[model samples]
Target chain A: MQFLLAFVIGGIICAIGQLFIDLTRSSVTPAHVLVGYVTAGAILSALGLYQPLVNIAGAGATIPLSGFGHSLAQGAIKAVQTRGLLGAFAGGAEATAAGIVAAVVFGYAAAVLFNPRS
Target chain B: MTQSQGQGNLQQQKMQQELQQEYKQLVKNVKPRPPVLKNTILAFLVGGAICLIGQLILWFLKKEGLGDKEAAAATAAIMIFLGALLTGLGIYDVIGKYGGAGSMVPITGFANSIVAPAMEFKREGFVFGVGARLFTVAGPVLVYGFLVSTVVGLIYYLIR
Candidate 1:
């Protein structure tokens, strides 16, 4: 049941992205959808809306790029409470540091080791 | 003779415009429309499948006694690794072709965005090519995600 909910919720979010691509005739690329989702997710998280979704959907809510935004907002909000204004500048990146660093390290390795095909 | 020449030029311009318009109509009629419904279904299924995998990882981590936050972070790292590995293997592109946003919306897609361009630009050397182009697709995501989250944090601070 948890997995099913996650699948449905996550799938819906991605389907929305697909709709944006098709309706825009590819003018709105995948990168645009990703950026937009993150921004929207942060705004929604700030508004105290995304958490409930996360509670219900678990990884389904948190796995999408929007969930990444949610974590950033959640981190900043947590930081502000504990560390004051200084946390605002650092918390967002700190929370996501693991993912970003992993991507960079693994991405660099992949680039060095593999060749791209046409 | 000058007046006739001006009239002839006007006639020529009109004929050219008419030909262009006809060609546009023909091209429009021949171009096939995208399969919107099909793509949406594939995106939904593929995106959902990826998230299900994430959820399973999260569950496994929980069973191993990790807290929620730690597990989520580890899940993301693992997913990113999988994405990069698949991209290196040239399989992620196949998934992207079929899954579209479904494949691209997950963290794996983020990895693909970084790795695909990095691999493509390898001939230009690491610093100028791989390093520089690595974030071409994902750079905006990080820039805006942090910027907006900071603003949201500021607002929260002021409000409370």
Candidate 2:
């Protein structure tokens, strides 16, 4: 069931991205991606909805930018309460480390498998 | 004869205007952006495959009695290392070329962005070596990501 959820959620997110590609002529995607994630996280957090989504989707919810935001926000909040301001700043990165690290490694493999042409 | 010549001149001007309008429409409607349908399908499949592989890797590690965090971190390390290795091997460049944002939209592209520049600059110097340059492109992304997340978190924290 969880796996199904992951599959569905993950697929949906990608599909949405495709829609953006199809609809928008905007070449400026990175900014949009980053902003979209943070906004999603903020809204979900406000509703107290993201935590449940995380429970359901795992990386499907997380591997995207919004997931990164949730992790960071959750971490920062936790750290600030326990360790103070310094903790707030550093905690977010640690929380999102898994996804960030995963991205790099997978990306490197792809790079190795196929050489890019200029 | 004068009336006939005027009609011919007017007809030519109208056709020219029509041609210009069509050119403008083509530029407006169809762009050079990567094909959305294809990229979405590819990203979903490839990204899902990567995650599935990760879960399997993590399960095996956990079965060995490693804690969840340890197992998860080990898997993440493997993924990050693989991504970095490919960036070095120049294989990822090909994926980026073919996949466009399809490959990049996933974590892999971010990894490549962070690592590729560093590898290129490895020969520059040690202090300002490949390691330093590693974050060049990716740093801004991380910064943006980090700040956004922090602010969101704060908002969440303050409210709830």
Model 1 per-residue lDDT at B55: 95
**RMSD, every candidate, angstroms:** 3.5, 7.2
Q: Pick the candidate with the highest lDDT.
A: 1
Ten residues in sequence with the least summed lDDT for candidate 2 chain B: B98-107
On DockQ, the leading prediction is 1
For all predictions in the order shown, the interface RMSD in Å is 0.8, 4.4
Q: In candidate 1, what are the lDDT values of residues A12-111, reduced to their tens digit?
A: 8888888888878547876798899899999999989999989988888888999999999999999999999998988899999999999899999998
Docking class of 2: acceptable
* Model 2 spans > 4 angstroms off: A1-5, A29-47, A84-86, A96-118, B1-23, B29-34, B97-102, B123-132
Can you write out model 2's per-residue Cα lDDT over A1-118, one digit (the tens) per residue? 6555655565566556556655776674644554555556645653568878766765556544455566667777777777766666777887777666665545434433443334
Query: What does the lDDT come to for candidate 2?
Result: 0.61
Task: Give me the displacement of residue A75 in model 2, in angstroms.
Answer: 0.5
Judging by TM-score against the true structure, name the best candidate. Answer: 1
The C-alpha stretches of model 1 lying farther than 4 A from their native spots are B1-30
